[model samples]
Structures are given as structure tokens and as C-alpha cells.
Target: MMESIVDSMLAQETPAPAGNPIESAEELSSIAFGFMASKALFAGLHVDLFTLLADGPKTAEELAKAAGIPLNRIVTLTTALASVGVVSISDRKLIQNSSAAQNFLAKQSKYDFGDYLRYQIDQQMYPFLLQLNAVMKGDLSDDAIASYQHWMADEEQASVYSESQHAGSLGPGRTLARKVDLAKASTLLDVGGGTGAMTISLCNEYPDLHATIIDFPNVAEIGWRFVSEAGLVDRVRYIPGNAVQAQWPGRQDAILMSYLMSGVPGEAVADLLRKAFDALAPGGKLMVHDFMVEEDRRGPALAALWQLQHMAFTPDAHSLSVGWLTEAGRKIGFAVDDVDNLIPAMTKLVVFAKPS
Candidate 1:
């Protein structure tokens, strides 16, 4: 019965053309088995297989010796990794298939995001997603899974969460910096700014700009460290508190909320938008960078998946739409100036401006 419901839901959510039954079945199978690929990637990261192959190609015996695993297991894992294009085999040696692995998967690289892949995606989110069926059935209580706030309240958890998310945020942060015009703005407020990734990126782009990051105390501590490491400690400061209830420092020329709104209850978004409007200076701008579905709430597969995953943990959190945000901003007396895709179809940037 549950299987039938789930299949019905998928058919409605991602319907294929009327005559393309084979394509539909293939796509459905791919979606159902996505966990296999995810686990393969996670296994590679767990054993530092990518890092081991960073130097050059390695024979199965060499990989086994380096990774401290059995040769048979190494061969099996490498075959899976090779199938995924992360690694390749040439003349009985395994090689990292793409430069991306060397630059972003190897531990020694500055752009390495292995921790994010391991901790955030594999360890945390993967298990959380097992509850999706229960979540959709409304069988899980709010406390069934810890709220993000409660999860981050523990200093250790907060540290891990902040650090992992920071790595993933860098590229999007850099992209945001390039797209937005902050030249005339002196002060920016980053609401729920975890570890200051976007803040640091923005400050790097606009030397004269200073940023204040508002987030929980533990995350703020981690953010401070990141700011200090960036040598922008003087320009970026932490305001440690719950952004939703805390008193925002007023007179800000710009505000940023990246990947924040979707974590909070949907009912709170309007209030938060109102606060941003009130806190901004007369001509200030407010930016929301997040995962948004199309106005009809159909599939951009990644965004839709993320929305469902968020719903499993966050009671009222769901993927919102750009049209919804534009309407909300209009009610608060701010005009929607621009909307752009920050990361192709997955993430979006919507800019709203206070009337001059």
C-alpha cells in the first residue's frame, strides 16, 4: 500500500511524456537507486581513497596497502568509483579520473570538500532521509528528529556543521560576490550566517564593506575563527543570537540570508522579511539566496529532493518559490529588483530593494 502511494506521488511529481514508458521506468529506477551512488561516494571518502590516489595511479595492491583495506575490497570499491567517473583504471592501475578529485576531494588541497561530503551529506542527511516516508505520512513528531537549532546547540555538533557547510558554501559565495553590486554599500548584515562563508567572500570582494553575522552562539564562535583566518576579523564581526528573535542592528545598507529561510518554519518567513525591511537603510538591498522550486511547485529534481529532506526534520520548512518571495517583499514595501540563478537550477538569488 505504501509502495503504491509512493509510486503515485513520484508519477505526479515527475511525470514523463505519455508515450515514453521505457524512459520513465529508467528515470524512476535511477531515482530509486540513487542511494547506491551516494553510498559509493561516501565509502570512497571514508577510506580517503581519493587522497590516496592524489599523487598518481596506483595498483590494487598499492591502494589496499595505502588505504589499509583488503585488496578484494579495494578492487570492488575502485570499480564502483570508476563507474561513477571519480576514478578510472588503466593497465591494472587505478587513477583519479578528474582534476576535480585532486582539487576538491584530496585532503591536501585547499578547496577540499571531503569533510562536507562525509559529515554533512553522508553521516547526517543520509540517515535523516530514511524518515521521509514517515514524514510524508505525518507519523513523526517534531522531536522525532532534532531541530536544527537543538542539533547545533551542542558545541561539537555546531563546530562540525559549521566547518562542513563552510566548504560547500565557498563556491556559491564567490559566485554571489561576483553577481551582486556592493560597491556603494558600507555595512551588510548576514542573518543566520553560519561560519561566515558568504560574509568572508563578500568582504573579500568589497574591501570597504564591513559585515555583521547573526547566528547561534556556538556557530558564531566558529564564524569568528573563519573571519580571523581570512584576516578580515576587523571587517567582519559576530552578533551571536537567534536571528529570528534577536534585535537586528539597524541602518544596514545591505542584508544577506543564504540557505537560512528554508531551515526555519515557513510561518516565520514573513516576519523575518519584515525585520529585514525595517533594519535596512532607506536605499538598502536585501538578498535571499536559497533553494526555490518553480512557482507551480513541480520538479527541479535536486531542489525538490532537498525540500523533502528539510521537511523530514523541520516541521514547517519547505521549498518556497521566487514568486512567493516577490509578493512577500512587495507587501513589505520592497520591490523585487532582480532574480538570478546562483548555481544553475538548484539554487537561486532574489534581490529586493527598499525605496530610495
Candidate 2:
């Protein structure tokens, strides 16, 4: 009777294969195995396979020698890299970067963005495992890329950030950059700009525009180097200052505060926003770019995850919704406008035109 009951249940048409319970369970299992995928990638990155291959293809044995890791580990790393689409194997030899790897992981590549993952391996991702604790309790740290900054300067991060950050990733600054008619704006100030990558990109794109990037002392030095390297020395200036206590030099056409907002308490961010607004000329525009949550705060995946990721560095680093920002602007004496999503993503530019 039990067998007959089971058969009867199985006899009912299972719709699409992907929709079937068995398939769904398998899909969930695959999702649960995501850690293995991340570990495989980390192992490949740990050995400098992508950086080594940046020059040209090399055999797994050669990679093992260059990376100073075990031969057995190299085999696993190389094969895993290939499986993960970061490398390609041709004729039993491990080739150099696959297109994706070259673009983001290869250190030498102009579009390299591997710095984003350095934190992943530094065990900073360990905190993310404590995400629930963060949500229920509070953040885990008091610094922004504190360990990472300890290792590399802002220029290092900028070099990688410039080429790799696509049009609309998962944040606000890039969104504002795309939406603004940068050609019309003559001057821009990137407050706490990491390495002036975004500002310089704007200046390069708009011949008439000039920009200034401000950050910590060392990061400012790096920003200057990037500006000089880009041959934007005359156009983009670097100001070494902290956004917390430093007074920004205003009187500019526009200001960009991106990615920086979420790394602090809500009150602190508001203070900076107000300060930025006060610094702006009546006709100037203040552009605020940061992650914005939905009305419910349960989100578009990546942004939701980012909320947990900001723990310890910035107390109330939750994603502020559009409504929240618009209201904030209205309370202050500026008009807040939401830049439509030209690219499909979570990034939305909030433009607060100061009577311009």
C-alpha cells in the first residue's frame, strides 16, 4: 500500500524538469556548494596563477614553480581555475588568463580589479559568515579596508578600480557619473575619492571638466600619481583630507560622494551630506552616490549582502532608500532627483541640484 501510494504521487505529472522537487533540491544543493567554488577560486588566486599568466600561458608545473606552491596543489588549482572560467587548458598545458581572468584578476592588465578580492582571502570574508550576528547585533569593525589599506595604498586600489568597474555595478557613484552631463560641468570634487579613478575618467571623457580627489594622506599621494600618470595633472588635483573633520573647498560645478557614505553611521553621513551641501554654490549640484535599499529593505541580493558587509567599519551602513534621500534633500534646501537606471542594476544616482 505504501509502494502504491508513492507510485500514485510519482504518477502525477511533474511539470518542467527544473520545476520538479528533485531538480529543485539538486539546485539548492548546488547553491549550498557555493563555498567550494569560492575556495577553488581563492586557491588559484593565492598561488598567483592569474598574475603569472598575465604575461603568457604557462604549464601547471611552471606555475607551481613561479607560485612556490606544491605540485599537487597546482594541479588542483589549475584544473579548478579552468573549470571556473578564469583560465583555459589547451593541449594539457594551463594557458594564461581566460578573458574574464585577464580583465579582472591579472595584475598587469589595465582593467584589473583583483583588489576587490584581496579582502576575500585576507579572511575578511570571515566576518561575512557572522552576517546574521551583525544584522541582529551590530557591525564587526571600525575601519574601511583597514587591513587592505595597511598592505597597499590608494593608488594600487585605484589602478585596479578604474578599468574594472563597469558602467553600473552595485553602488551609487558610477550611476551618478553616467547620469550627469559631465561635459557641462566644469569642475568636480570627489570627496574621499579612493584614487581619483572615477574623477579622472570623467575629466578624460569631458575635455572641459576639471576634478579634485580628496582622501587620506597616503591615498592623496596615490591619487596625484594616478592623475599624473593619466596626464591629468593639470586638470585633476588631489586634496589630502579626512571627510570627517576636513572642510572641502567648494565653489565647484559638481561634487561626487560615492561608495564612501555606507562606511559610516547614518548621522555621520547626514553631517557630511549637509556639509557638502553647505559647501556648494547656489547653482552647484551635489551628487550623492551610495547603495539604496528598497522600500522594504529586503533587496536586489548584492546590495542586501553589502549591508552586512559594512559591519564594524560604519555603524549604520544600511542601504538608504531613495525616498529617504529625497526627503533628506528636501529638508535641506536642495532639490533631489533620482537618475533613472540607464544600465540594469542597483546603482541609482541621486542628484541634488542646489538651485541650479
Candidate 3:
């Protein structure tokens, strides 16, 4: 009887929902005030609160003394940190709540990513988001908001940006190396490969794979240092110039363009794709890993937010859709192979291949 009932239910076709369900006013408000939580986390990271608590629990007074901040401010900050679950307050002392805080937040940890949050997200992108309204309205002049080229021209800013991105990219880079098959490929072209994080990760994974990283001179210099530090200087080389304009070093079996498309104008993407296609040997693979929106572009809230953030700085920055990319690849004589979300609902990897 149970088997029959289950079969009957399975035989019935259910209609799909019409559209996204409307969010509650309170939920909408929470989304709007999300910056408060971000700011709190940033503040905690900025003061190295997690690192201070790494030894053990500490009283607000002790934290204030160690961090050289006022006791009152530390108290308030600890309370906010507690609310965010990064720290816990027990017996009037604060303790690091999770291993994430200990591993990623602490300065002493080998996998520390605190600098990424501090420099890229907090110092750079946070301020850029504030200008979204002006940017959308076209009130902000091009010179007023610095493009990636302009920003990277400043060596100090480029170093900070590159280092921060390199730190943040490590985990994702390892994941990419594991997920993608590079065993058959001999040469890879890592376009706009900042600090050689991804290249280093890939080379570490594949013993026979050699990679050439192409980026601006300032970023390329930093990448060379990182590659050298990783002892991958022999396999991974840096080419200092624009990925789109500069002469591609040689024909590659695989090419990776990560987090580069969203920083450029939409019209320029096709040209870049064409360039990648032309630079690849027959049957070569091209991997584009970046944030992508759904066909409808309604809300995968993170991607939408990132798109808005990019718009604030870049003149034509917008989240590309997978369908568009597949179509674009088809037009460029490449076969679209797969589109998979590397970071569930956030970053996507769209893979294409040149026909042999």
C-alpha cells in the first residue's frame, strides 16, 4: 500500500513557482542594514581582536590595554563581536568562538586571511560601494573614480591589493586546482593572475604543468615574489603587460581568466574571449572563473551585490550571465563544455574548449 501511494504521488506533475517570493519588510530592512554587521566584523579584524584572544580568554580591560584602545570602546566592540559569533563573552571575558576566527583571523595562523578582509574588502571595496549612487547617476567623473589600471599604477596600492587578493585566493585556488583536470595539459596562461596565487596552487598540484602569469607590471612584480617564495619560480613565469593588449607569450593548452571580466566593460569581454581562443592551441581549454548572475538576474544576493559594487568603480562593470558567455563562446568557434558554481551560488567557472 505504501509503495502504491508513493508511485501515485510521483506520477503527479507539479507546476513551478511563478517568481521569487516577496521578502518581508523586516527581512528587507535586515538586508539594508547588513553593512552594520560587516563594519563590526571589520572593526574586530582591524584591531586584531581575534589575535588578542588567541592565547585565551581576556577581560575587556585586558583587551583594551593590549590593543591600546579605550576600555569603553573595547567593551562595546566585544559586545558587537559576540553578537556576530566571532567571540563569546563568558565570565565577563571574551573568547574566540570558532576555529574560523582562530585560523583565518589570527595573525599567527599560517592560513590567516585577515589582511584580505582588512585591505581589499574593508579599505578598498567598502569605500567604492559608497559611491554607487553617484556612479549610477553618471554624476561621478571617470577620473574621480580610479579604474583598476589607474589604481594599480600606484605601486603601494597595487602591492596592498595584490597581497590581499593573493591571501584571499589561496583557498579558492586550491579548490580550483583539485576540481579542474590539468594532468594532460602542459602549459597554462593565467591572465591577470595577481600575486601568482592560482598559478602556484595549480603548479603545486600538477608536477609537469608550467604556467605563464600575465598582469600589469606592478602586480606582476608582486606575483614574481610570491611565486619565488613558493619555490615555483622555475615553473611559473610572469609577463608584465595588459592581458588583452600585450603579446601572449606562447600557445597554451589551458588558459585561466579569473575575476577579470567583471572589472572590464561588457563589450570588451568578447574581444578578450576571442583573444583567449586565438592564443590557445587546438583542443585547448579556457576557464573563466568569476561571479555570474542568473539569466533572469533577479537575486542571488551575493552576485547582485558584487555587481553593484563593481559598477561603483568600473564604467561598464556588470555581472555576466552563463548563457551569454556560452553564446559568446559559440560565436568565437569554441565549444561550451560546462558551467559549475565553484563557490555555491557565488563564484562560477565556465569552461570552453577549442575544437581540434
Specify the highest-lDDT model's number.
Answer: 1
Q: lDDT for each of the candidates?
A: 0.83, 0.63, 0.82
Off by over 4 Å in 2: 1-36, 51-68, 79-99, 107-110, 119-178, 341-346
Assess every candidate by TM-score. 0.90, 0.72, 0.90
* 10 residues in a row with least lDDT, candidate 1: 1-10
Clashes of 3: 0
Off by over 4 Å in 1: 1-26, 91-95
Per residue, candidate 2 scores C-alpha lDDT tens digits across 3-120 of 2222333355531222233367768987788677777776666666788888888887888888898888888777876776778899857567888777667777654546556443
**Across residues 1-356, which tens digit of lDDT does each residue of candidate 3 receive?**
01222223335553232246657998787768889888988998988888898888888888899999999999888888788677788864655546667766888876677888888899998999878888888999867988888899999999889989987787777777877898999999999888888888899999999999999999999888889899987898888887767888557999999999888988889998999999999989999998888888865666667877888899687578898888988999999877876655566889899999
Look at candidate 3 and give me any clashing residue pairs.
none
Lowest summed lDDT window (length 10), candidate 2:
1-10
What are the clash counts of all predictions, listed in order?
Answer: 0, 3, 0
| TM value for model 3 | 0.90
RMSD to truth, every model: 7.1, 10.9, 7.7
The order by descending lDDT is: 1, 3, 2
Model 1 lDDT, full chain set: 0.83
Q: By TM-score, how accurate is candidate 1?
A: 0.90
